[model samples]
Target: MLCGVHNHDLAPNLSGHLLAGRLRGEEKQRVIDMTKSLAKHRNILTDLKEKNKESVTLI
Candidate 1:
């Protein structure tokens, strides 16, 4: 299950590169937007996890 989620998360990045030369203007822009959004969310998740770890350590 975790592996599946990891693969799903990577799919867009892989697709963007695989289809890079083939993608037209709007499609390429869409991929870039999706990647940016994913990165933003991933950063938020990482921050939350770090905070959780710190709290656990203090407990």
Candidate 2:
């Protein structure tokens, strides 16, 4: 199931690379956008950890 979804998602990237010459324009932009979004999510998690530094206690 996961493999199918992953393959479906990868189809466009593979098509773009094979059909076209290189990963340019939207493809590159999409990679950059996804990277930035992931970074932002990581940052939010870090910030949340800092905010709860004194409150959070492990059992």
Candidate 3:
């Protein structure tokens, strides 16, 4: 008997994978827009964290 190792990981294109075969029409677009917004916010937060770290290191 042979078994395969399976990994449950989020796909690299998470937004597309999340929306694929799940949503359509306006709803899908809404989700995509929401993801974009969330990504923007995440980037902003990451920048802030890096800046905070730099300031802390300098002090």
Candidate 4:
């Protein structure tokens, strides 16, 4: 939701739909796109996490 933060992981409904395998065809493709976008976002989050850890160690 909110642009790139397709944090379906943060909500139960999206996870339920995904796990249930209820989505079909284009709907599934749409979900895949959303998940891929999230994966890209995750890479940034991981970098930020590592940077945060470094900053904490420096403190």
lDDT of 3 by residue, 1-59 (tens): 22664566556543334334343355346546756777564554454436444221110
lDDT of 1 by residue, 1-59 (tens): 57546544444333225443254465446546756777564554454446444221110
TM-score of each: 0.30, 0.28, 0.27, 0.28
Provide the clash count, candidate 1: 0
Model 3 TM-score (2 dp): 0.27
Better of 1 and 2 by TM-score: 1
Q: Point out the worst 10-residue segment of candidate 3 by lDDT.
A: 50-59
lDDT of 1: 0.45
Model 1: CA > 4 A from native? 1-21, 39-59
Which residue pairs clash within candidate 2? none
Instruction: Quantify all predictions' global Cα lDDT against the true fold.
Output: 0.45, 0.46, 0.45, 0.46
User: Residue 20 lDDT in model 4?
Assistant: 45
Which 10 consecutive residues of model 1 have the lowest summed lDDT?
A: 50-59
TM-score of candidate 2 to 2 decimals = 0.28
User: Per-residue lDDT tens digits of candidate 4, residues 1-59?
Assistant: 77868855655434334444343365446546756777564554454446444221110
Candidate 3 lDDT for residue 36 = 72
Candidate 3 vs 4: which has more TM-score? 4
If both were scored by TM-score, which would come out higher, candidate 2 or candidate 3?
Answer: 2
lDDT of 2 by residue, 1-59 (tens): 57546544444333324444344365446546756777565554445445444323121
